[model samples]
Target: MTGIAGVLAWIEEHLGIDAAKGGLADAVLRHVKERCAELRVSPQSFLALVERDTTEQEGLVRVVSVGHTWFMRDREQLELVVGRFAGRGPGAPVRIWVAGCATGEEAYSIVLLADARGIPVRVLATDLNERSLSFGARARYGAWTVRGLTAPEREKLATPSGLFEIPERLKSLVTFQRHNLVDPPPRGATGFDAIVCRNVLLYFTKPRALDALRRMRSVLAPGGAIVTAASDVLADGTPSSDSELPRALAKSPTAPPTPVVADLTPPAPWGAEPAPPTKAADAAPVSDAAPREAPAEDGHGAVERARSALDRGDVDEARDLLKAALERDPLSIEGYVLHGIACDASGNTYAAMASFRSALVLDPSLWIAELYLGLGHDRLGAKGDARRCLARGLELHAKAPGLASLSSATQAMLAEGRAHLVEAAAAKLASL
Candidate 1:
């Protein structure tokens, strides 16, 4: 491996951050050298680019934090924002925050999405590093960063020269600031309706991630959601709950799953054999029972009944039957997946996520379950979880058609779901 790859590996191992191959590390090194020349960075300072901050100048930690953010990054999330806030009679000014907004893709993407719904928005876009923040304030992007938007979305939201010329109308909606996640958000910054911080948190240890999540929670307004890269989650380590809380986890774009052998779940009856590891006495209990659902008479029969109802356009009936099946056999992966799909069709998004979770517990390799999980999270406006589920599902499913065995009606719905997710992910990246 070259020096850059070595650095990439170090970053991944230490920070769990994805560093691009090729000369990206070289580019980051060069940028850091040029930017830190005044401070006379030593080898230690160069390496400190990836370290956690302890001093007041922590925001200056350098390393080109180019996220894979494109325009309109999560189209579905944007759609929800537009339709719910803008499509409805607009009243209160929508307050949004885009944290770790490297080069402004996420911030700009929100602008594009909000514009589509005709909802006026105010965004506070911030980053720890000044270099990335500078680019965000400029809002100029090249082709790679502009990939997600439809021609019209691009034209309407972007300047002719590809710079986002902040419109006076929208200017009141957005403010650029610098804030570090390691520390409290600057005193003046508090309370937001939604937060978009995509593809930037693979950079810290678990403790650091947890700290960032707590701080995010502190700033979020009631009913507000937080967004992250597809694979990232709230470092808060809190098990998700159904009770409405001040903060909730959002689904990010779906990324690939980790290697099968590396998965935390036990291996399936037929997949790869895993090496046994010694467990501590206090290790968390592994529930072999598939996330405990209600009992079913016959798993296969339940699937068929749900499928028939779905085919006949009885969406509500299908949902109800699927739920019944899950109640009958909580460990039934098929039942859980079908239930999730049905719930989505019936618009009970959170329940759909629970169903998907049950299914994932029963069968971690069920790519279809992951896809459903993504859709459910997206519907709940949990973009971060949605992105992770989708990305991991894509990794597991690869070229597999998740709805291949379903009837045309069901297939159509599945296809629509997939398309929406893909477009949403594309859009989320565009603003990066």
Candidate 2:
């Protein structure tokens, strides 16, 4: 039998939990089988030794139990927490807990953020596995864990080995311990300002999940909030309410709000006179035309400016100008679209999606807007939307040569996007 089947059988026997009942262990085990090979566990061979229940079995299980987390795991949630608690002044050495802190990425990130803000935070980082704790205590990290850090943050926080060097001055501010959330947390581990268990509790049964949450709540200060992965934090069983301190914070709504009516309309084309204003109800909606600024002097002219900056590889400058143009006039659909382009160039896919979505909301009939939105969605791993948008853009382009002709650079992007969606869809289907 495959190691996954063996694991399922072994878990059912020892934990007295049935995989047939659809427990967290079942999901975790499946993910473990898929990813185990990367982590160096031979899933196929591991299955053969299930009856042994030896040290290797425990080792295999621990590897499966530990989770993968990174700095800024949920980027928006990190921003919110930093804004809420760490932004506060040196107040009684603000306490925080990171449960199931495997490999210490999230815990270390919390430390870095708190220190950067000069908050007096005492962090208690814990995990159930001794080996995982040892790895964390060593403070060495891989490149992937440090991917999100800004250069300054990296310089100030992490050692050359990629671990945050716990400076003596801040040594008292953080502690690491090995504790299982399945048991009561160690004495004094509770009653903190915030508890971050993002992506961890999704591995437990509902009863286990509730118990762990209650433990998190028992020690949480009246207003303290628990942050979990967006996948696990649901409205049906959420811990936060409208007015109380949250036991858990649900994912913030990410969809754009309904578009508000505006007085503005797109500028008339180059040499034509201004079109007479039609009544609001009778006016034909504007296409994706943008607000025009008198072209900046001493630079490549308007049409070439964004392209020139992109060509010269001055990405930050391009992004800044695009952002400024958008802010100066929110009606600038071109500005919004280009800002999304700049964000994608700079490797901020999430921010790019937000920008693209904003552009489409301003002018839904815009094929370029739809095209770029599809590209952004594809890059962010949304294949279905990407395919639909690309097909839609092609349809519009067929109707009008002006609509169809993409810049060579954008054409290359479209090609790459198409390739990625096809590959992703195929892999997903094969897995099923």
Strongest candidate by TM-score: 2
Q: Tens-digit lDDT track for model 2 on 143-238?
A: 334545776765665654334454655554556675656566455454566777754443344555566666666666545666654434222445
* TM-score of model 1 vs. true structure: 0.44
Q: What value does the lDDT take at residue 305 in candidate 2?
A: 71
lDDT of 2: 0.52
Can you write out model 1's per-residue Cα lDDT over 278-297, one digit (the tens) per residue? Answer: 11000000001112242455
Which ranges of candidate 2 are over 4 A from the true structure?
Answer: 1-54, 86-91, 158-172, 233-432
> What are the models' TM-scores?
0.44, 0.47
* 10 residues in a row with least lDDT, candidate 1: 280-289
Clashes of each: 49, 1
Clashes of 2: 1
lDDT of each: 0.51, 0.52
Candidate 1 CA-lDDT value? 0.51
